[model samples]
Target: MWTTGAEQVEQAVAECVELLGAVTGRDWEGVRAGRLEWSCRRTAVHIAEDLIAYAGQLAGREQESYAPFELVLEEGAGNADALRVIGTTGALLAAAVRTTPREVRAFHPYPFRSANREGFAAMGVAEVLLHTHDVAEGLGLAYEPAPGLCDFVLTRIFPHVRPGESPWRTLLWATGRGELPGRPPVAGWRWSNNLVLGTERLTLQGVTPAAAADLAAVGDGGFAWIEGGPVEGTRVGAGLVHQQYEDGVHLPEWGMYVLVRREDGRAIGAMGFHGVPDAQGRVEVGYDLVEGARGRGHATEALVALSRWALDRPQVRTVVANVERGNTPSQNVLARAGFARVAEDPGHLAYELREPGEG
Candidate 1:
């Protein structure tokens, strides 16, 4: 996914340059970029600005606010010069994406405060594709990016939007550039990054669809793990998340999360919900740790943070977990996390945590 993303930066820039080069003699400053209030020239510069900024984030591993510099063009620059800048910045972003480790997330102030390499790539591609369309619309030129590019961005970033038959059209609609038949007009929007939760010593990183795919295929899901870590259960959980993405019903915030130790960035375990919250505001939870990392209360710590996060949401009133009958350690972890034994089946015991005021 990372390789494809970087390759796409090159392709998208090439297409945009070719399309806009055909009309360099025209007055870009006088024409508005599609529905945006900014002129076509300004929009073109915005594209270059975003590309370079994303590159800086990845290259610098910016964790908090944005990097403290902007990409301002030289004096006497024209549409042609802007296009050249776009090409250069696009290449820079591609290089950054290629070199940045998959687990490295940087500042991207969308709904979430950070984004991984794939997320940055998808956002970069979207910027190139959409702005090119806007410039083309203003210049009276035709523009349509590849369907696969649109699909890549949609699946990676716009997880909440229902897909349409046409990926380009759907992507255009997602960014408020066009329309889909069944959906309402989007007047306000924010691209969602994967949610990250911090505990006293760990950060629970949400697994994206791309990461989930890699994890399901016996990959590390881009995490550095503890000894004998990312056990079988993590792989199985990743498979389920990947399947949910394929089915287009995966709520990104409800998917699996890897618990990474803050001191060393080594992943200790995985934990998450079975699915989205039910109508009755109930959801199932599960967790597992590496054999060497067991009995250290990592699971208990993660469960408490995750359970609190879940119950704090309006749609979740209870979180439940099912443990094998003989797994005393697991049961103890749940008890430590404030989950009461709720019920028992033939082979397992059910534990639950209700919102304090509810019961």
Candidate 2:
């Protein structure tokens, strides 16, 4: 339920309202929220505003920009009224999250320009948890949300933050709301949503760590695959992805992707980076298809899409691929995808595709 969205948003909102509603008669306007310039009253209204905005984006299927509307409270409204608005908007967000399909992506401009249901829910939960802390601190009301909610947000969106001794404290530290023992002060931060790109017949679905762990265990990674699907290499790649995730070094975009046929929704293959772009901006890539689906140009299509996506990144100057010396079919796939045989050895062959301007 937490992973899906609606239940988690409801859970977070329940905690937020219960905590703040208890102190409704306090001087919310006079007391500044902890570590923020806004008064506690303003912070409460911001929560409602963000919740409704997210709901609008999903419910309206907003693309390219936010749904052009703002939440304005009536003049002379008090703290109880603001808390009521939070509950109402929170319900709207929950309904939106429940109704939005997993495949549907809406506009969000952070590291990427789009976000799916899970991303919006995680963002919503983060806002409620973090800002409520600020409000609680200022009003001298005790508050600590469920650690599981914090864990959910961190894993789904805050993939770059390493897990610390305490999940809640770690989340606070990651967001610049608190301190850690040794890590540098977080001067800036942004949440990342997984990227999806489409080809003629395939959607290169970015693999989340949750999916990776299941795939590594020979599961479908929540994707429906063609018969004789997800061969050993794919599982091995998934294991590698899960390892990176467990180590907290996995960037979702740089991780694995499952190639799913759009028409029938059957997964055809897997393709992705071996790791993030190296210091020189060189990134290694690998791909494999199910036996029954091979030789249909699926590998070539996915390779081209993944390579194009990688090269388009300003940090990536080249994409590297390694094939066993005897693998003629694999070499043909790479060649068809426009990768050149840049180097070779006794047992292995190397290919590299460089950005157009790379010397």
Candidate 3:
């Protein structure tokens, strides 16, 4: 799955070209009638423009948030200039991806910019796969994606699918289907009711360092006499402390914070948490620790602390964590932290803990 930028660029360019060729071979009437909705002509133009816009963003030329679609839609379909824009964008993207550094900062479709090469490639792949299908289907042609590319699309786009939702339905929903599932309904965009996609629950929470005690306690790994150990302010194993901030920085929105300390004042280890939150005031909990700090009872202490902090607030009533199947170390840690094993997911496990006072 580790691919070079040059390789990705070639793949993306080829996919775009194929879509254009497919469009040329198709008739345009039924498409114009909403049978497939817009004609293959509109489909090709959209693909080309999308590629050009992405390229411009990568090159730091145009702001990524500029919506060429809405602009073209307002400008009326079949505008010759749109094709030129599309052609230019595709070329630019193909060139940039091969040469840009992974860490280079560039604006993305949202108001913000991405800070690395992976983000850009991900954005590119998403566009090529999504629009290629759009053109193929609009022209009434059967187009099969390369196996690897489809897998990549599934990873990026499938997590957006909720239980009981069809991936096909989700695709339609994503591409302006009825009320878009798995995403907040945008005012102007009607989601497609035919695909399998819906909003998923990802209750997250934010807590201060002192409040993470319940999560920290589980790191003890069965060793006694090491309660309340010093939190590692630096790396002890694969996990980073303060000094290793960069390594974990990529996980900006999601990652764990640790607390460590022993009764004897030596640092035992740390723990982590992962949860989802919304306006409804609910959050789940997750925790982890490094190898050396295991068996010292630190994880239990941290869990208690974090749990107490979360429960005291009117907002949070439950915390949840998932462990891999057969990962006894993690399952044991969760148990010691007061979480009861609840269920299994594919190859992992799930546990839940109610706030101390919750019934």
Report the C-alpha lDDT of model 1 over 1-359, residue by residue, as the tens digit. 23437887788888888889889789999999989899999999999999999999999999998999999999999889999999999999999989987568899998888998878988999899999999899888889988878877877787666667999998888788788887778888877778989899888989877677778888887788888978999999999988887776898899999998888889988999989999999999999998888878788989999999999999999999999999999999999899999899899999999998888
Q: Between 1 and 3, whose TM-score is larger?
A: 1
Cα lDDT of model 2 overall?
A: 0.88
| Model 1 superposed RMSD (Cα) | 2.7
Q: Each candidate: what lDDT? A: 0.88, 0.88, 0.47
Instruction: Give the TM-scores of the predictions, in the order they appear.
Output: 0.88, 0.90, 0.45
Task: Check candidate 1 and list the clashing pairs.
Answer: none
* lDDT over C-alpha atoms for residue 148 of model 2: 83
The Cα RMSD of model 2 versus the native structure comes to 2.4
The TM-score measured for candidate 1 stands at 0.88
Evaluate residue 236 in candidate 2 and report its C-alpha lDDT on the 0 to 100 scale: 94
Best by TM-score: 2
Candidate 3 lDDT tens digits, 1-359? 24424355457657556555534534543465223366656655656656655565666634345434332443544433444455556566767766664324455533123323434554566666566566666655665556555433332322223312443344444455335434654334211110111112111122111112222343422122144443342123213211122221212222343343322323344334343344555566555444566776656666666666556667666777777798887788778878887788789998878866555
Tens digits of per-residue lDDT, candidate 2, 283-345, equal 999999999988889999989999999999999999999999999999999999998998898
